[model samples]
Target: MGKKAEILERLGGIAPALRRYSRALCAGAGHTLSDELVQSALQSVGARIRARELRPADLQEARLEAYAALTASAGKRLTDASRPTPRHPPIVHGLAELSLDDRAALLLVSLEGMGYDAAARVLGIRREALLAQLMRARAKLGVVGLPPADAESGARRAASHLRIVK
Candidate 1:
């Protein structure tokens, strides 16, 4: 297969994981917030591809670019008031308190099972920077690994209430 085709295939495999991550990021499903973000990211990538700003060979870069687009538009998706109210476990509350990047890093690592190197690439940061972000996020959340207590389910429930109204 061609490079772009290959990249598209990769996107297919990772899309579900991205959706789960999105659910976690928006604090729980939020209408189709994650889908919207992924779609927006695709459009952004398409534009870049047309402009020759992104080469087919740069699939990883494209992934980063698309995710950055998703993240850039996250604030709007996170503020809708119509979504279901999520239950707040201590972890969810703690996650809510983190910066967007920190939350992304923590979720990507702990929840999504991404290695620091891969997560860092997705975040467009150096590995060391990703590690720091993870550490700070974990410290804030008060856990080293995924906590299986009320925090885990609470985070999911709380995330659902975040209505990404767009």
Candidate 2:
């Protein structure tokens, strides 16, 4: 295969992982966001590959760059994914509790599966600072109500409804 084809193949291999990461990144929001984020990230990465801005030796770097691009894109919009969420807990609460930088830091590292160094690079911050932001974000997550036990039940119901729709 040609170099461009080879790179596309490699990116395709990583797409499922990217989707899982994106889902977790936008967890507690809406289902549509997971698809949107993954699509955006892949498109950004594909563009970079097509432009030859990323080399084979730098695939991981390219992935991180793509993730950063995705997050930056997210930062620009008022994207309310059309998926209707439960009214009781308020969809925006957990996210709103976080400072934007902290939320971005948490999502990139924890949900997007970007390593600390990679996430730090994406956020243009030192690893230590990124960790601190993540810590703060996690702490803030606890203040919200839903509680751990109820989350599973609620998730199951949501999953059942989602599956029915599908």
Candidate 3:
């Protein structure tokens, strides 16, 4: 495969995970914000590639960078009006109790099935820091499963119901 193709292939392999992670990063902000975050992150990655700042070999790093940057940016951009009452009230309640960093760590490792080191890289944190956040998240999650399967299905159903406006 050519360099561009090889890089895109690597990104494609993790596209679903990246989407999942992006939404979970700021779950309380509502799907609209989370979806936009993913779009922005993808555009950022493409921009970097076009600028020749990101080489094909840096796909994994780029993926991590994109996610981390978007998460941070989302924190700043999220507004009170944009905040939705957590749809799964109970689950969202539990997650709401944890810090954003903790939630991100927990979801990256448990929700996305990422290894501790990989999750840390994505968060731009040390493995030890990731472990601490993960531990905190796990404790909080005892009350709320990290990746609520039903929540995901509900999201998918909602997406299916969306109609394009002319």
Candidate 4:
């Protein structure tokens, strides 16, 4: 395959993970907004790749780039003062309580299964800083000592009130 085709293929492979991460990032905003975020991120990444501004050596690098894009886009939206607040479950409200950095750190590491180095790179922070942010996020969410599965399940239960529309 040509270079562009290869890049497109790799992006397609990471789309599911990107969507999941975007949803977590959007939490209370619901799936529609999250899907839009994912689309924006993908477009931004694709444009950079095409312009030769971002050259991912492999799938992992591509995933990081995609994540960085999504995080940036989400940050802008979350910080927009004019945006109306949407009703969310208590769990989502808890997530919204976190600073953008903390939430991104927690989700990138916990939900996306990104390593400290990769997550740090995506957040444009040092590994130590990432750990600190993750700790704060966990503490805020009261999931400090809980296992990952338990924390995730709790979030799922809290979000269960949201009905999924086909």
The global C-alpha lDDT for each of the candidates, from Candidate 1 onward, is: 0.64, 0.62, 0.65, 0.74
Give the clashing pairs for model 3. none
Query: Number of clashing residue pairs in every model?
Result: 4, 0, 0, 0
**Which model scores highest in TM-score?**
4
Residues 25-130, candidate 2: write the lDDT tens digits: 4544555766777788788778878888766454576667666766666566424443235652432456555666887786665555568888899888899999
State in Å the error of residue 165, model 2.
18
* lDDT score for candidate 1 against the true structure: 0.64
After the best TM-score superposition of candidate 2, give how far the Cα of residue 65 lies from its true spot, in angstroms: 1.9
Model 1 regions more than 4 Å off: 5-13, 56-61, 75-77, 80-91, 143-166
TM-scores for the candidates: 0.65, 0.66, 0.72, 0.78
Q: What is the lDDT of candidate 3?
A: 0.65
Q: Candidate 1 lDDT, tens digit per residue, 1-166?
A: 8776666656545555556566667654464777877676677777767677777565665666666666667756676342335554445455566778898887777675667887887787899999999778767665533343356565664334322212
Candidate 3 segments whose C-alpha is farther than 4 A from its true place: 9-15, 79-89, 143-166
Predicted candidate 4 versus true structure: per-residue lDDT over 1-166, tens digit per residue? 8766687677877778888777767766667777888888888988888888888876667778889999999988765342225554455565667788998998887677779999999999999999999888878776623322346556664334222211
- Once fitted onto the true fold, the runs of candidate 2 whose alpha carbons sit more than 4 angstroms away are 2-4, 27-29, 79-84, 87-96, 145-166
Whichever of 3 and 4 has more lDDT, that candidate is 4
